[model samples]
Target: MKQLIIAEKPSVARDIASVLGATQKSKNYIEGKNVIVTWALGHLLGLKMPEDYNKDWTTWEMNTLPMIPKKTGIKPLPKTRPQLKAISQLANRADVSEAVIATDAGREGELVARWILQYVKFKKPVKRLWISSQTDKAIKDGFKNLKPSKMYDDLYYSAIARAESDWLVGLNVTRALTVKYKDSLSAGRVQTPTLAMVRRQEEKQETFKPENYFTLDLTYQGLSGKLQLKNPRQYKERQELEKLIKQVEGTPIKVVDINEKTKKEGAPLPYDLTEMQREANARYQYSAKKTLSIIQRLYETHKIVTYPRTDSKYLTTDLKQTMKDRLQAVTVMDSDRVKGIIRNGGTVLQKSVFQDKKVTDHHGLIPTEQAPRLEKLDNEELKIYRLIVERFLGLFEEPFVSTNQTIKAEVKGYIFLFRQSKVETYGWKQEKETTQKRVDFKIGQVIPANFVINKELTTPPASLNEGTLLGQMEKHNLGTPATRAEIIEKLISSELMERSNSKLSVTPKGKQLLTLVNPSLVTPELTQKWEISLEKIAQGQLNYQAFIKEIEQETTALVKEIKMSEDNYVDHSLTTKVCPDCGEKLREKNTRDGKIYVCSSEGCSYRRRKDPKLSNRRCSQCKKKMEILENKNGAYFKCKNCNITEKLDPKGKKNKKMTKHETNRLMKKVNQEEEQESPLALALKAAMEKK
Candidate 1:
């Protein structure tokens, strides 16, 4: 009898099938003598929407403030029904004995498989294949030591609880606010608090008042020192600073104290998903979502890196045995550095890098045994891969040893401090060169000195960039590593926040959202507690049902607050342009594509691009660029000057005239492509096609 193995994605299924000797491939699955491998496209099913439970909930109304269903159910996602149906057929096959869950090893991944199993009513015994990397050896070893499905029941329960609770709180609050405020506003357990944090920072920026101050800089024999004060670091009055500088201008400086110490700094921990995201945002100005997408490709498509959604930065103790192989896998990127480390017996495990207790769900992001072809990775992928490789190598390098020296000097009864660091060993910081100049000083020695007074003004807090916002999210425990990027992107898509000059700021809509949202929901405290409870549920320390019951109670209170609140919401984005369909004012909205005008009327679903996207296709008559516009018929290019229109074919080529049937088919294909293809996904697909 053959065992049915279900994977998370088709690409992943192919990898697993290859390792399991399931070479006989079909459209939906691969089969061998003893195994059949099927796959899910991310998630085959999701929690049912409110309208599925009650028809009355279809329309938004204040009366249905809190639409809580008696039981939350799962439904097959429309786009992926074919894959789900195929998996169901394979599960019930006569030759198939038991099923294996080969999805990604995480809470959501477990939910994906469990929902399908529940839907199919598969009564056969089930096992799970849990492995971090997609390398052949890891897959083979995972199957050989498959664990019973019951082992992860708590994790699955936790996933269900999280999904249900989010639906209850997010949907009810979002509906209540939208109906009462007459705007498309949204709030969530994680997203609302995150937006509130940005709004709060913006408030600080708006209310800040700068104060002028002065400081004295002391220079003595090629050494620099700043005047240290007792209370405020800067002198508030210019006259006070001038007097101090005059007193110490020609005074001989006496070194009162000298302290020297040797310090050893260990290498930084390896890349967890959050840390990697933070670094990528700071260095490359990549959005959290962008970095996650790139790293995910490195994990899922290239199979060069391990899991990308991990929270742990430490490897399990058992992974120590495979360290050499992982190091060797990345040698192609920097053969000299990796080979040198391996030759010097530097692959020995360290407690800082290998601790079984610290690893949860998956180990830190590291290269797999699959050696990467540098050419296969695009520019952004190469940047991320290089980060992971450098971090991994740092684990085996020696500690950075330095001699730190601090000197305290007194001139005219005022204390000044000078500090210097001399590097004794570069260690893991091999990429950087130390430029510190060594200087010797003895206590009670007088030195020639000069002083200069400099004026400065205090500045308001800087706006939160993607990197800093991610740091705040990590600090508040707002969301998991896997979901934080999605939350940020959601806030942007919902028009609550925006990105400008590489900094995150609360939009006018977002500022109003904070004032209108429930007071408890605006702070991180509520969500932090929820995240802690969810973690407890995953660890079996808390009952999932009880935790969800608390969330339901909170949802009821939040909805009631919104219903009773007397606050008013103003449509700041409303424009003078009126919607042609409903005679309502059009609201200007900023989108990634560009600004667009959306109808302000809640009941109207009218919107159009404020500025039409220019296409390369030129007007045959005018020889000028044409504007691309879409209608019920599909996308077509029209020339503003020549008043000529042409239909766009499926391949984006222009045709003078096309049949109605062809236009409809092209529109359907275009809709599907827009719905399913992200820029990174399309790029990866194109790259794979090239291969």
Candidate 2:
């Protein structure tokens, strides 16, 4: 009998089918000599919503909350029901005797396939094909040595516990807050804590008090020293600094001490999703979500990089043998880097990069053994690819060697120190050294004297950007690398956080929600503690049922506290604009596209885009074409990605004048341009061919 292999998505299923020679295409599957391949488009089902179990749960009433059921049933997702039906039939086909799960080889992936099996009631023996990348060779190897599906039972349980617990806590708390405050506020097991982090940072900014301070610097011929008073480096008062400046006005500065230490810094760990996202955010100013998307394309579309969602930065010991192959793959791109890598890595691998016990979900993100064509990469993809390449190359290169020089100077009794760093070797950074900027001071050497007073103000902490937010999320265990970007975006889209250029600032509405929610709900430590327990469940150290009970208990306490609180919640997003239909104040809300002003009245259904919507014409500011949209009033044009808008000029007076023929011709030209692949698309095509 033939075996049926199910993958997480069609793209992945295609990879498996190609590798296994499943050439014949069926309705929702591919057929081979003895095997059939089908795919579930990501998740075909989810845990049943509370309202699905009880009709009363549909209404937003606090009385019907804590919507706990004895057993949460699963249902087919409406959008992919047809595909699900097809896969179900494929799984139960008489020719199929056994099944294989080829979904993403992670905790969430296990749940995806297991849920499909449970829902379809597939009774045949099941095996799992677990591999990190979708490269042709990796797929073949994974299928060659498939593991029993039971091996991932604990992982599936862990994922179910997380999902069901999120539903319990998120749905109940969201309902309670919405009912209490009469605003659409959401609290998640993970998202709430993530929002809290941004709120706390804002609190720091609001309370910050900048203080002005002054420093007196004394410099002689070749010696420089900052004047000190009472052993403090800077004078808190300008008057105090001036007094110190006068005291040492004529004192000659002389070198007191010079010290040097040779130091070496080991290469950084390989790219984990968080580290890569952080680097992209810092260097290229790309958002975490953007970095994740780019890297995912690099992994899946180009087959150049490994899995993008991994948290581990250390490779397994088994991967050590394959390092040379990975290195060889990049030789065509940079032979010098490959040569350097081979020189150092031909022996034992770096001790820091091969710790098996340190690895968790997957090995660190690395390149597949597919040679890259650099000329095909676009600007952004190339930037991210270079980062991964440099990091991977570092694993095979020597540690960065440097010598640190510290020089000390004294003016009368006051003293100051300065530092100079010299690179002994650039090793992995691959930078050329042409000049050594250094100041040499001989002991007891005196130089011409001068004093200057420098004044500065104490600065507040930097505003939270995507990079900083991801770092904060990682630190607090607020969300996984795969989910942190979405959480931040969610906060921004919910009007709880605003993305200003690069920094993230909490909205006033965000603070109000934080105040109204249960204190523990916003604390990341609670989520982090839950993550610890979930890890246990995945490892079979704890039963998922016990974990669910804990979440239910916590949910009960949180709901009780929220109900008992005498505090009042005011809608901070309430705007003065009155809804024409209901004469109630409009509420400001944020969406992925832009801002919107909606009627506060429950059934009024009146809404307006804060950023004006479409026009077929171009924007005057950015000179980009705009979209046209209509609210209750009239049609307007807006450039959603930029700040450009205009009301309808149906008379064609304000818009660029164009005859019908000319407009049609220009539109045809634009359509032709849109049909072609982007530059990054060219890169993906190149990498795919390399395979």
- Which candidate leads in lDDT? 1
Whole-model Cα lDDT per candidate? 0.84, 0.79
Following a full C-alpha superposition, what root-mean-square deviation does model 1 have from the true structure?
Answer: 5.9
Q: Model 2, 114-225: lDDT tens per residue?
A: 8898999999999999888777888888888999989888889998987788778877887788787777776777878888888888889989998877877665444456
Residue pairs clashing, model 2: 221-448, 613-638, 614-627, 614-628, 614-629, 614-637, 615-627, 615-628
Prediction-by-prediction clash tally? 0, 8
How far is 471's C-alpha from truth in model 1 (Å)?
Answer: 1.1
C-alpha lDDT of residue 10 in model 2: 70
Instruction: Mark the 10 consecutive residues where model 2 has the least summed lDDT.
Output: 675-684
Q: Give the C-alpha lDDT of model 1.
A: 0.84
- Per-candidate TM equals 0.91, 0.87
Error of 2 at 380 (Å): 2.2
Best by TM-score: 1
